[model samples]
Target: MEAENKKLDQFTKEVIQDAGLATPSVDFLANVMAEVSKEKVPVKVYKPLINKVGWLIIGTLFLIFSFVLTRFSLGFSILGDWDLSSLMLEKHEINVDIPITYAYCFFFLLIFVIIQITMISKRFSRSLEN
Candidate 1:
């Protein structure tokens, strides 16, 4: 029995030695890296309801409207009781006096609108490029 066990162990060892070490192909790493670096299909992400150009136009219109409203509300008198022909004929001198707080608020709103417009346009351009 002991001789038979020894012979079986020797046979198993010889079989394992004959198999030797298994290795991957030489280009295995390069092939994996190439697959990892391959470009994928770009996906379009929807963000806002309006497009960049639409937002820009809307911002511009809002800016103009706000300026006109502010000017009129601040001091510029509307044609209330003056006849248009008489007012046009006479040399009219208009004076505009803007308070510091109002001026600051208007400027802040203007800056905010400009920044929003710029960001929207930039995002739109980037999306187009992708």
Candidate 2:
């Protein structure tokens, strides 16, 4: 079995060497490039998954939900017979006195990060368009 395998491998090598290497025509690259250049390159237009109208609707719904929740918490029952008073959540207040300077620093850092993210996204979008 080993001898047969060796013979087969030798035969395969001989046949391949006899066939020699295949080469493309001198103008193969040029022809391919010419055809490629003639083809139309599709322009990709960026579309937001959630448009302005969608965002506006979402924000409006969020406000409405918040208002309803606030009213419910303040004993304003939407359902007349059913009482939701028992489901009232307790509000815990933490009295941690953070320094004014620390708050200011945090605020400024948040603003800086937001600005940086905005700038980077804009630059990235512009690059994609190009």
Candidate 3:
């Protein structure tokens, strides 16, 4: 027990000495407390009508943004076709604009994202109802 006590005392003393070496001035702590005390508490802004309108605008923007993005992305294949021409698999120039593959992929991803968001929204709405 005495040996353990001596080891613990030595460790504690070492930690204290190390901490003391890195200690900030008392004035720094005083200034920090003063600054904290001078700061104002943040106010929560609430306007039910404005909030509803804001959300409507945001929802509209998201829908339009998704529509435009999907439209462009579906047309992405025309910019540059992947060079599958190296091997004896037959060199072919792909015209992306008429291709249905990009359209299919775009629709699939959009559907998946919409379904996931709908599920989450539904779950939250259900919880709110309960």
- State the C-alpha lDDT per candidate: 0.80, 0.84, 0.72
How many clashes does each candidate structure show, in the order listed? 0, 0, 0
Compare candidates 1 and 3 on lDDT and give the better one: 1
Candidate 2 clashes: the total is 0
Candidate 1 regions with alpha-carbon error over 4 angstroms? 1-90
lDDT of 1 by residue, 2-100 (tens): 999999999999999999999999999999989988968787765678989999999999998766654444333475654334343235666779999
Every model's TM-score: 0.33, 0.52, 0.28
Query: Best-fitting candidate, measured by TM-score?
Result: 2
Q: Which is better, 2 or 3, measured by TM-score?
A: 2
Least accurate 10 contiguous residues by lDDT in model 1: 81-90
**Ten contiguous residues with the weakest lDDT in model 2:** 85-94
User: How high a TM-score does candidate 1 get?
Assistant: 0.33
**TM-score, ranked from best to worst:** 2, 1, 3
Candidate with best lDDT: 2
